[model samples]
Every structure is written in C-alpha cells, then in structure tokens.
Target: MNIAELKEDLISYSKTIGIDKIGFTTASTFDGLRNRLVKQQELNYQSGFEEPDIEKRVNPSLLLDRPQSIISIALAYPTKMSKRVTSKKGERRGIFCRASWGEDYHYVLKDRLNKLEAYLQEKVPDVQLKSMVDTGELSDRAVAERAGIGWSGKNCSIITPEFGSYVYLGETITNIPFETDEPMEDRCGSCNKCIDACPTGALVQGGQLDAKRCIAFLTQTKGFLAEEFRVELGNRIYGCDTCQTVCPENKGKDFHFHKEMEPEPEVVKPLLKPILHLSNREFKDKFGSLSGSWRGKKPIQRNAIIALAHFKDETAIEDLTILLTSDPRPVIRGTAAWSLGKIGGDGAKTALQHAIDMEQDEEVRVEITKGLQLIEE
Candidate 1:
C-alpha cells in the first residue's frame, strides 16, 4: 500500500483498538515541543520528576534517524466518573482529577499502541516501529495538534471538541511515512478562566506554567511542603484540576470515571481521623496502584494530614496526636504537629505538648510551636 493507504489503515486500526482519536505527523514536530521542555526544565518547572534530560527527552533523532513520520493517538477517559465530584460540606473529600482517575492510562494506552505496532510490522514487512504512551521523548500533544486530533489549549493541554483535555496521548514513531493531517488553530481566544482559576498562580500572563506553584506538582512532591504553599493546597491530596474545571470548554463533558482510579467507597471521603490512623503499610495497600502512589505513601499521607490541618477540625486532634508519636516519616510527624496546632483547642494543646515531648526532630518541634500558635488566640 502507498503512504496514503497506510495512514488510513493505521487510523482505522487505532480506532478498532479503542483509541478515540488518531493523527499523523513527522518528527519535525519536536521543534516547538523540545523548546517547551527545555524552558520548563530551566525554570525548575518539572517539580518531582527529575529535570527533563534535554538530550534524551528533546531529541527525536536519538530514537529514530530515518523516522518518516509519527502517528499520534488519543484516548478519551470517561469524564463522568462520580469520584471527580466532591462534597462542599465541612467534611470535604478530595477528588483525583479526571486524568488520573482510572487504571493507569499509561499502561493501558501503551498496550494499545503495542498492538498497533504489531499490526504495522506484519503489514509493512520491514518498517521500524516503536510504541510509546506518554513515556517517551516525543511530544504527543504536538503530534496530536499537527495530526488534527486536537489543538493545544492555553492550559497547555490538547483540547478536542469531543473529549476536551481529559484525554491520554500516545504515539507510534515509524519509518513509514503516512498521509499528514492538518494542524489545528488555537481556540483559546481571550478566555482566561483557566489562568484566573489557578489557585497557586502557576499560570503566567499568557500560558506558561511555573511548576513550583502548580498544586499538581505540590501534591506529588515528597518530604516537607514549603510553609507558604501549605494553606494554598486546600484539600487536594493528589492533584489539582481547578483550571480544567473552570474552563468553558470542559463544561458539558461527563466527569472522567474509571473504578481502578478511584479510592474505595469508605476511603473515598474518610474523616481526617481515619486517614491519620493509616499505618505506612495501610497507606501503601490503599493507594499502591494509583497513579499518584508511585511516590510512595509519605507525600500523600502528609498531604492528608495537611488537609486535616486545613480544615482545622477539632476532631482531628486525637488522630494527629497518634501520628506525632507513631508515624515513621519525619515530614509527616512535623506536618501533623502543625495540623494539630492549626486545629487548636484545649485538646489540641494537650496533644501538641505531648508531641513536643516525644518529638525527636528539631523541625517537628519547631512546626509544633508554629502550628500551636496559629490557633493560640
């Protein structure tokens, strides 16, 4: 088959394999994408992920020199999942932003891409084919935009008329040239809802994001969260979706749903007391397969304690007390002390004193004093 026919076959096969959108482009799409990755790394915008290794992540040549074109694939995750919505009451629960609420999309998308690769190898006989699902050096969004599957929104996400930004992107890099798709135009217009809605002011005047200020990054980071940003975290324990939620483009879509991505029913909106009581083992067992779980339990557990502190619920004092003395991670211990203090009362004062006496880490002790004082009046 000619390149045109090959492109049609690839797109058709991709849809049959469960992908929602498919587009084709060349390796040159890296020009703009590579620049973005480098800029983000230079500004320390990557947060927890190691600085994007420019040479490794940016260079398409490293993966395929004779690469004729790229086939970009998009998977629209169900946006109507019940877990995306949280209660507005005092006992608030956190939601895993749509993208992360399911069986790991990376694995799922990659499996489909692998099948496409197998199909192409059999059809093309000797063409080089490599499959990647958001795990590789190429820019899947750039490819998507060029392939006409979507346009990159001002929020820096690929936006499709059907799926918006609640889609996972993957691609197949191969030496077989495919019929090219047209590039999409920017539809953001004068809309600034996404920028204005960002709680941490992560978005700049235009669309640039300061990863350090991004709550998504903050929730994933390990160890002690910066004191200044703690209150800004609100109740987000995993990632933040305020921008997407505020985007007009996402308004009518169903909330993304995938049971594998959700917390258990009881755990979905547990009281602060129950979360503080989760041992390291329990925390691991509860969140092990989650997309956010790769960083281990300490960061999330600490965030949970922070959320408890944020609520300033007096009922959290007993749980915070246990964590102060029994939790293994020093960050968790210190943050728990801070939370207890934030939840101030006679009971919290007593717990804080107990924490101070048992606390071995100077940081924890300092936080205890600071947190206690926040509600001292």
Candidate 2:
C-alpha cells in the first residue's frame, strides 16, 4: 500500500465529508504539552475536568496499540448569527459562547470522525483506529497543532490560517504510517489582545490559562460562583468567548460551512428571565442539542440570575425574588440573593430582608446580607 497516495486520498475524502481542514502527524508523545500541563498542575491551574492521567493525554501509544500516525480535522463554526433575535425593551438575554452556538460540537466532530474512521476501515480492513473529540484523553488543540491543522494561538485555541480560531477540532489515532504535514509558525507575535481581553484574567500568560479564573470554566461550574467572578460573568451563561472575539486572527472569519454549525440566535441567546423558570425537561428539550447545556441547567440558571443583575432588569426582580425565597437548590437561592442585592430597588431590598430571616442556609444568609449591603450603599 502506498501510504502517501492513501494520505492524499484521505484528504480529498475529508473535503467531501465537510471537514474544513485535515492534517497528519506522527503519533509521538506530546512532550511540550506534557511539560506545560505539569506546570499547570503544579500551579493548581488545572480545571479538574480534563483526563486525570497526563500520560494518556499526551501519549497516543497508550490509547492505541503501536499507533503510527494521528489524523486531525478542523470544522469552522460561524462566529456571527445569520439571523438576529429581535430585541425588545427591558428584555435581557444571556449568551452561550460561539463554540456552543450550534449543535454540540462534540457530536458534530464525532460524526465526521466516525465517517473518516469508516473510510479508513474500508481502505485497510485491519486498521486500528481510536477517535476522540473534546472529551477524549488527547488534547484536541495539541493534536491539531502538531498535526499542522493550525498553530496553537495565545488564547490556547488552534488558529488555522483559513478559519482563524473559530474551528472545532477532532482526531483519530491509527497504526497506518501516513505522511505528516508541517506545523505552522506562530503568527501571534507580541499580540496581547486575547490575554488582555479575558474578562477574568484567565489567560495567565500567552498559551497558559488559569482555568479557575476563566469565565468559560466558571460558567460551567454547578456550585455557587465566587462573588469575584459573578461580575465578570456578565451575560455569558455558558462559555466565555471574549478571548476569541478579541483575537486579530479571528477578524472577518465567520464561516457557516456546516448547516449544523450555524447558530439559532434565539436559542443561543435566550431571555434570561425565562431561563430562571425552565423545568428540567423543558431545559433539555430547548438546549439539549447545544454543547453549553451539557453541565445541565443549574449553572446556566445561576448565571442567568447574575446576568439579570448585571442588566439591572427591574422586570426580573419578581423572578429573582421567587428563586431567593423558595428555590430548592441552595446555589440557585444563594445566587439569586446576591443578584437581588446587585439589582437594588425597594422590592429587591424587601425580598432580601425577608429571605435573610427565613433562609436556613448560612451561605444563602451571607448572600442575603451582601444584597442588603449593596442596597444600603
């Protein structure tokens, strides 16, 4: 079998199947990424959502028997919504990040990977291949970078020359000795845009992130968000895109190549007040297809309360009061208490004062106190 010919054929096949970009690299261990990950761990900057085993994350050999090469693919997603949701007076909406704008990228990328895998299987019946999207052990960014799909940008995203950083990445490890592509040169010379644009200062430095401080990570947390991050979250209910949105490389780079990757403006940016009252099934039915909904509704609801506070939506005061006084979840009740304080008014202050007396949870009580303090000042 001519490996080079097969590689070219695979590239052609990829274009037909909606893969925006494709590249290959040797299945060597990602030594540089491993070192950086270790440093991140030592500094306690790890998000805790990643695969715990660093070996499995950087070493493709561990994942597949005698892995020879890795094929990386990138699919560009639209940065701007083609259609706009008509804005009404006093109506506040919360936004999911661009990455979560379309159908959950995990499913979309996996579908493409599965197709690539089938193509390889047809060519070489005994090919051993292991495919993974974001949730997999392998770091998609690192794989994409080494595979020449894109260069690792300062914001820690794979910035393809054609698609900027607005691309979804996936990879497949196989025992085929495919020809590899050359890695791209870093073009982010002295550009501090993404680092400076991070609302929570999550970008500790170029190519390094303190996940704990990242609004993207914070938005996904299922617990009470620390008071410091509440203000930083603004209207971002799911993931934060400030870093990507500010990148110069991403300028004028919106692509709607895949129909599945297009954003439904109304769904991605929904009314914050309505999100506060969604039943679990209703939440799933509306947002289940989007990747932002993976953490379930609690975090989104909590962020929505904070967003309402950010907007000082007098209209949502009633809704916030309901959550503060009667919500079963302590985090939701507590977050609502803080937001009420931030959105100070006679009614909000009254609700906070009443909740302080009836609230049993110490944390919720503390939030209520904070709310009252904001109103007082």
Candidate 3:
C-alpha cells in the first residue's frame, strides 16, 4: 500500500482501538512547542524532568535521530465518570479526576500502537517505528495541535471540540512520510473559568502553570512539603483536576469506561485510616500498577492523612493515634498529628500529645505542635 493509504488505515485502526482522535504531522512541526518549553524553563515550570531543554524536545533529530513522520493521537476521558459532590458514607469522598478514573492510559495506548505497527510492517515491508504515550522525548501536546486533533487551551492542555481537555495523548514516530494534517485553530478564545476555579494560584495570566506551586505536582512530589501548601492539598491524595473540571467545553461529557487498572477494591475511594498503617508491601499491593505508585506509599499515604485532616473526621482519632506511636514512618506520624489536630476533640488532643512525646524528629515535633493548636482552635 502507498503511504497515503497506510495513513488512512492508521487512523481507522486508532479509532477501532478506542482512541477518540488521531492526526498526522511531520516530526519537525513542533517549533511552537519548542518555544513554549523555553518559556516554561525561563519561568521554571518544568514538571517531569529537571533542567529540560525545549529546543531538543521539539527537534525530531534529537528525539528520533532521523524521523520522517509523526502520528499524534488523543484518547477521551469523560467528566461524568467522576464522583458527585456530596460527601457520604461508603462513598469515597474527594477526587481522582476524570482521566485517572479508569485503566492506565499508557498501557492501553501502547498495546494498540504495537498492533498498528505490526500491520504496517506486513504491508510496507521496511518501515522503522517507535511509539510513545507521554514517555518519549517527543512533545505530545505540540504534535496533537499540529496534527489537527485539537487546539491547545490556555491551561496548556489540548482541547477537542467534543472532549475538551479531558484526554490522554500518545505519539508514533516512523520513517515513512505521510500527508500531514492542517493545524487546528485555537478555540479557547476569552474564557477564564479554568483560571478562576484553581484553588491555588498556580495558573498564570495566560493559563501557564508554575509546577513548583501547582497542587497536582505538590501532592505527588517526594520528600518534605512546605507547611503553607499542606492545607491546600485539600482531599486529593494523588492528583488535582480542578483546571479541567471548570472548562466550559468539558461540561456533561462521558469519556471513561470505569476500568480501575489494578482493581483495588479499596482504592475506588480508599479509607484514610487504613492507609496510615500500610507496610511497604501493602503499599505496593495497593498502588503498584497505578501511575502514581512508583513514589512508594509514603507520599500518598501522607497525603491520605492530610485528606483525613481536611475532612476533619472525628472517627479517625483511633487510627491516627495508632499511627502516631506505631507507624515506622515519621512523615505518617507527623501528618496524623496534624489530622488529629484538625479533628479537634479531647481524643484527638490526647493523640497529638502522645505523638509529641514519642516523636524524635524535630520537624515531626513541630508538626505535632501545629496539630495541637488546630485542636485548641
């Protein structure tokens, strides 16, 4: 088959594989992405990598050595899959966002892309191919914009007319040259709901984010968190999806199939009490297959304790008390003290006192004091 026929077949196969949109462009079409990377670097908004070079990311030769064509794809994740606002018993209160509500997109896309590559190899006989779903040096949003899959919104996400910014992206770089799609027109226009809805002032004037201040980055980051940012973590233990929630275009759409990648009966709305007691093995058992599990259980478990604090659940005093004295991780003990203080009952105060007496780490002792004050209030 000719390159044009192969391109059409590729798009058809992508749709069959459950991808909502697919578009093709030259690997070199990411010049605008390169510029944005520079701007992000200058402003210090690099998220995944430290000291990222935008110029290299957009340059195909740097990414693929001699790529001729780039295939960009978008998978729709619906807002309807998210839980309703009312906090209730048995209902896991808080947010996992819409995109992460189902199976991990990386595995889903890679399995399908590999099949497509095999099909092309049978027909074309001598094509070189490599695929990436947010894992390669290739710029995903950049190629999606150039390929006409969607326009980039002010929030720095690709916005499709039907799916908005609630989509996952993947790419394929191949030696075969195919006809490229025209770039999509920017449609964000004058909307600012995404900026207005952000609980933290992470969004900038043009919808760019400072990763250092972003809650999405904060909740998943390893190590010590700034005291001021702790309260703003709210109830999110893994990721924050506020920007996408407020997008006018994303309102009332169904995108996910509700397939939890690892099927942890507890993770659908995991209980904060149990999380505080997790051993390293239990942590891996619960979150290993999920995207954020690589950081181990400490960061997420600490966030869970903070979320319990946010809920101010008096019922958690027993669990928090046990964690303060018995939990091996100082971070968990410290966060439990904080949560106990947030709950603010006689029992919570007693737990905080015990944690303080048992605490050896200075930072933990300081957090214990802060928790005691919250109880006093």
Candidate 4:
C-alpha cells in the first residue's frame, strides 16, 4: 500500500466533509503531557473530571492495539453571535463560554470522525481504528498539538493559525503508519495577556493551570462555590472565556464554519432570573443539547444565581427567595442565600431574614448569616 497516496487522499477527503483542520502523528507515548499531568496530580491541580488512569491517557497503544498513527481534527466554532441578544434594563443574562454555545460538540465531532472512519475502512480493509472526543481518555489539546493541528496556547487550548483557539478538537487512532505532521511553534512568546486576564489567576503562570481556581472548572462543580471565587465568577453561567477573549492570537478569529457550532443568542446567553426556577425537565429541554449541560442543571443554575448577584439584579429577588426558602437541594439553598447578600436591598434583606428563620441545613444557615452580614456591610 502506498502510504503517501493514502494520506493525501485522506486529507483531501477531510475538507470535503467540513473538517476545518486535520493532522497526523505517530502513536508514540506523549512524554511531555505524562509529566505535566503527573505534576498536576501531585499539586492537586487536576479538575477531577479527567480520566484517572495516567497510563491510558498518555499512551495511545493502551487505548488501541498496535496504534501506529493518530489523526487530530479541529472544527472551528464561532466567536461572534450573528444575531445579537438585546440587553434590556433590569433583566440580566448569564453568558456561556464559546465552547458550549452550540449542539454538543461531542456529537458533531463524532459524526465527522465516523465518516472519516468509514472512509478509512473502505480505503484500507481490516484497518484497526478508534476515535474519541473531549470526554475520552486522551487529551484533545495534547493530541492536536503533537499532530500539528495547532500550538498549545497559554490558555491551554490548541490555537490553530487558520482557526485560532475557538475550535473543538477530536482524534482517531489507527494502526496504519501514516506520515506525521510537524507540531506548530508556540506563538505566545512574551504575550502575558491570557495569564494576566484569568479571573481567578487560574493560569498560575504561562501554560500551567490550577484547575481548582479556574472559573470554567469551578462552574462545573456541584458543591457551593467558595466565597472568594464566587465573587470572581462574574456573569459566566457555564464556563469562563476571559483568557481566550484577551488573547491577541484570537483577535478577528471568528469562524462560522459549521452550522452545528452556531450559537443561539438567547440560548447561550439566557436571562439569569429565568434559569433559577427551571424544573429538571425544563432545564433538560432547553440546555440538554449543549455541551454545558453535561454536569446537569444544578451547576448551571447555581452559577446563574451567582451571575444574578454579579448584576445585582433586584428583579430576581423573588426567584432567589423561593430557592433559599424551599429548594430541596442544600447547594441551591446556600447559593441563593449568598446571591441575596450580593444583590442586597429591602426585599433581599427580607428574604434573608425569612431564610435565617426557616433554613434547616447548617451550611445553608451559615450562608444565610453571611448574606445578612453583606447586607449590613
């Protein structure tokens, strides 16, 4: 079999199917990422969402038998919403980060990879192959970087020159020994913009991230957000984009390449107050299709309450009061108590007084006291 001809044919076929960028690399062990992940584990910096087995994550051979090559694909997502959401007075909205804007990227990228897999199977009969997206054991960014899809940016995203960092990544492992592509050069030299712009200083320094301090990671946690970081959560409901937005490389880099990646203005930036009352069914119906809903509605609703406080939206007081006074979940009740303090007013104080009187959870009571203290301050 002519390997060069096969690779050329594969690359040609990829663009026909809407793959924004594609690259190939040998399935050698990822030496650098193994060390970094181990160090991250040692430092207690991992987000806990990562696959626990380090060996399976770093070595493609562990994932696929006799893995000879890996293919990395990137699909560009839009940065700018074509239809702008009208901002009205009093009703505040919470923003989802760019990555979670559209139909869950997992399905979109998987659809693309499935097509590529079928094409490869037809080309090389009995070809051994495996594919994975973000939820899989492999680090999408690491695979993309080593496969020449893009460079590892300071924000920890693969920044392709053609598509910037606003791209969803996926990979396929195969036994075919295709020619590998050269990795891109790191372009963030002396560009301290992303590091300086992290809301919680989560990007500790350069390319390293303290995931516990990251707003994106924080937004996904089911527990009560820490007071210090809750103040830093700003208006982000699902994820944080401060680092990516501040990066110079991403300037003028919006690409609406795929319809699946297009953001619905109202859906991605929904009103903060309305989210506070969504039933499980309602939340699933509205946001289930997006990537942000992976952790379910609790984290999103909790973040939305914090976002309402960021806006100091008095309009949400009634909704926040309901959650604090009667919500079944302690995390919801506690977070509502905190938002009440941040959005202090006569109504907020009344709600806090009511919560303090009837709250049963010890943690919820403490949050209620903190809320009252904020109002007094």
Q: Give the TM-score of candidate 1.
A: 0.91
Model 4 error, position 363 (Å):
0.2
Candidate 1 vs candidate 4: the lDDT winner is 4
The TM-score between candidate 2 and the true structure equals: 0.99
lDDT of 4 by residue, 157-270 (tens): 888888779899999999999999999899889899999888898998888999999999999999998899999988889888889988888899988888988999889999
Candidate 1 per-residue lDDT over residues 1-377, each given as its tens digit: 78777777777887777777888876653666668777887777766464256655555557886788888888777655453445444455554555665566788787888898888988988989877766676666767888788888878788888878878899888888776788888888999989888887898755588878888888888878887779888777778878887888888876333334443433444444555666668876766556766677677778888887777766667777888888777888889888877778888888887778778888888998887787675
lDDT of 3 by residue, 156-261 (tens): 7888887778778888888888899998888788998888877777888554888788887887777666767888888787778888877888777665532533
Q: What lDDT score goes with residue 119 in model 1?
A: 89
Q: What is the lDDT of residue 202 in candidate 1?
A: 90
My TM-score estimates for the predictions, one after another, are 0.91, 0.99, 0.91, 0.98
Clash pairs detected, candidate 3? 78-255
Minimum summed lDDT over a 10-residue window in model 1 is located at 255-264
**Residue pairs of candidate 2 with colliding backbone atoms:** none
Give me the overall lDDT of model 3: 0.74
Task: Give the clash total for candidate 4.
Answer: 0
Write model 2 residue lDDT over 1-377, tens digit each, in one string: 88888999999999999999999999999999899999999999999999999999999999999999999999999988877885455798989999998889999999999999999999999999999998999999999998898899899998988999999999999999898899999999999999988888889899999999999899999998888899888888999888888899988998989999888898999988999999999999999999999999999999999999888888989999999888999999999988988889999998998888899999889889988999899
